[model samples]
Target: MKCFQLVRSVLDEIYSEIPLQDEAQKDKAIKDEILSLRSKYAKLLSSSRVIDYENPITRFSYIYSYVTSHANIVYNIIESSDMLCALMDSKKVSMTSIGGGPGSDLLGVIKYLTNASKSPTLRCNLYDRESAWGESWSDVDNKLENPFKISIYFQQFDVGEPSTWVRHVKYLSSDLFTMVYFMSEVFGNKTTAEPFFNNLFANAKKGALFLYADNNTPDFYNWFDELAHRNSLITIESTSKNFNVNYDEEKTDLGIYYDKFGFPKLTANIAYRICQKQ
Candidate 1:
């Protein structure tokens, strides 16, 4: 499937269930909510606990702005990486996406697999603290079409709490683990977050793939790089670039909201790293 087609389909699915009365109303609501949530999300990146993602509207706002943008970036990263291509060629693949709310990473994976014409039986586990995201992602899963089987499991797991990490032990034995735009969110509480990441890398199966993508923040990139080094994960590839999104092409209220907020254009400075457990 073409990238834009996949995006349109996913956006359509999300928009259909947004519980809005009309397009204009939805656009205004999303725009207002996105502005408010963007401030809170920014605080979250800085480690402030001022925002609550438990609210459905907050999650919806995030989905409209960051999720679509991140999904596009992930698709581009996978499309351009030979390592990712080889990884997707497997007949059976398991992937885990930490902080993968509402299927952004999953959609990116699906787009890659479909375009590559590799019909691997895929099992994806999406872990997030907000359980409501599970419902939205399940809706997305049901809407997708694939030649082979794909199963998505949603878990309400908190990465900050060490006690909750054990429940994910079984799912950690995955072919690939993705942390898209997640590290920045947790980096604020490094004291607590470090142990979880340390344990994750230490316990992951040998030869497993790890994909880390986030904003082009030096601190965030350095934190993950340090963890990779400490865990002896071999860095296969890493790059930083501008991730631009054409808001005009968006077929949902997101586009309208962007235009309304004077963000007729959108671009993100992103960095990505690919590593393999040694």
Candidate 2:
């Protein structure tokens, strides 16, 4: 029920599937992967490069390093947003997550619903460019002891390609839409990403709620506001703040890897917005 539960599940998947010669190798492998990824992200603040996700090592490395903090940041944003909370009042609610491969977006929402003890039936659709990430999170709902009826579906979505996203219309029905750290991820390819957002906002149903949480940078947050403005989405709240990963020590479950890599991202500097389609 807690978000850490989801974090443990990711670690479990990595331990089970990734092949290593020995415990020492795992320590080296995970540590090396994390450092390489860490360096890439650090430089990404200034430039853009498409990260390869086909490698299992790369994907798992991302899971170990970023998902935890991103999920927590999302939980903090929704916990403070009354508009997102209102969706829980419905008997059945749906959400669509753009670039949700890391599983942070849904895990964050799951954590909130558990903490609130609200058990409305929830449907989740994750749209991302990588089909490989689909399997990484396929067993999540099964692993977590969800109090509510929950179902998830993954669709291959390329933000730079309109051919892929245009075919998918079911997402338009979602009561909520999440773009957690997604804009920043695709910030380099804004030329193509913009059309995708344009079509999405122009067609999304009136009254649909949107949550945008990402880096506290002008390129990221400013791009979000421009699309919202073009679409006429009513802004509920928009601000940039610092958030720490509020984790329970008892729930921590990384075994040897914990000692190898000190911890995943424990804090984030974010600019977030809660809006309603009008």
Candidate 3:
């Protein structure tokens, strides 16, 4: 199976793990959770409150609606950036994904590597506040069919509690760093999130490449720009574009879920940037 197909497989597996007994009850549960997540995001857009990803339904809500599109977005950005393309060709790649417990960030890099037919050993650290998110992608290596090995670690990070972030020094060694749709999630708590970014830029390896993709809005991009600016990260290329996944490239595997949740996010207006800490 292809790397992007692995994303769909993950969604299928997570769907099975939902706490529902039968078809009817599962349908009801999925619909309700999707609505609840939408309401929570609406509130998050307007307030400082953080959603509880530890809640199983909320977590599933985000994974179902977003993981595939997000993975696709990050893959596009990575494949287009010359520095990341060069990194993909390296013998090994070390990356830290901030708030990337949903698994999209790593999947994107896998997709890029798979398409390029370059299977470098992957060392990835996916950090998030919700420990529960780790279970969702634990089997990623099992799903990948490449010759190279992959190493994935999940580090608990709480944006509201900066201490959890400051104590971690190992992530500073990453050759690439990604923040995919993560800025807006903790935007209201910038005071807490800002320090982590500062420490990240201050200590990251000199040749690290940073990839950022989020909603095409200043509320998100401005924070990314400010961090890159103060840190003197050189921009490779930056633009806003409407990216759509080639849904037809893969078979229609989301049939049942589509009937319930309308459809997964196939397209998104995303602002993306690729920067190098030279």
Candidate 4:
């Protein structure tokens, strides 16, 4: 199967396992949780409390709506960037995605590598507080015919509690690091997050690549830029773009939620930066 199709299939299988309830009741619950998550997501960088994804439905809703939407846009952004092209050309690449749940960043990297006809052995580590996501994503990974010889390791680390984030130290010094829709989630606690990011930059191999993609907001981008400057990471390229994404009705479960919730074709206002630790 094609890469995109595989993503859809994997998600379908995972969602299928979720026990069925009244369709209307389930939709309402999912919608309510989605709205709550959206509100919490916007304030994440500033909020002192951690946003919960412990609920299975909340996790599923996130993957169904937010994760899939951002993944599509992120895939497009990576595909169009020359900097990423050069980085992915290496024979072997190590990558880590902070707050990477259920493999959105992984899928994007896989898409790019497959399209470029580059079969690099990818060692990917996904860090998130939600350990359940690791199981769901691993199921998907096991079902795929991996062209890149990708191996994924999931680390259950809470970005909100940097004091307990020691597990990630061994995974530093990677060739690439991705923060797709992630900084905004933890930016509210910049004081707590700074040390982790600083340590990451300090330990990253020289010339290691960093990809930051998120909602195109001045405050968010400014925050990331500040971090880059503080760590002496050099910005290679930065750009913002607006694009519309349409969901496939039959190919993915995402369409079911979109239709139930009356979600429009997503207009993604996204900003991305490629930097290298100097």
Number of clashing pairs per prediction, in order: 0, 0, 0, 3
Worst 10 residues of 2 by lDDT: 247-256
| lDDT for 125 (candidate 4) | 91
Stretches off by above 4 angstroms in model 4 are 1-7, 13-24, 246-265
How would you order the candidates by lDDT, starting with the best?
2, 3, 1, 4
Better of 1 and 3 by TM-score: 3
Q: Residue 129 error for model 4, in Å? A: 1.9
TM-score to native of every candidate shown: 0.86, 0.94, 0.92, 0.86
Cα deviation at 237, candidate 4, in Å, is 0.7
| lDDT top scorer | 2
Per-residue C-alpha lDDT of model 4 across residues 158-188, encoded as one tens digit per residue? 7657665865567777888999988887777
lDDT of 3 by residue, 192-216 (tens): 7787788788889898989988888
* Candidate 3 overall lDDT versus native: 0.80
lDDT of 1 by residue, 3-34 (tens): 33444445555556667779888667767887
Candidate 2 lDDT score at position 260:
68
Worst 10 residues of 1 by lDDT: 256-265
C-alpha RMSD between model 4 and the true structure: 2.9
Residue pairs with backbone atoms closer than 3 Å in model 1 (clashes)? none
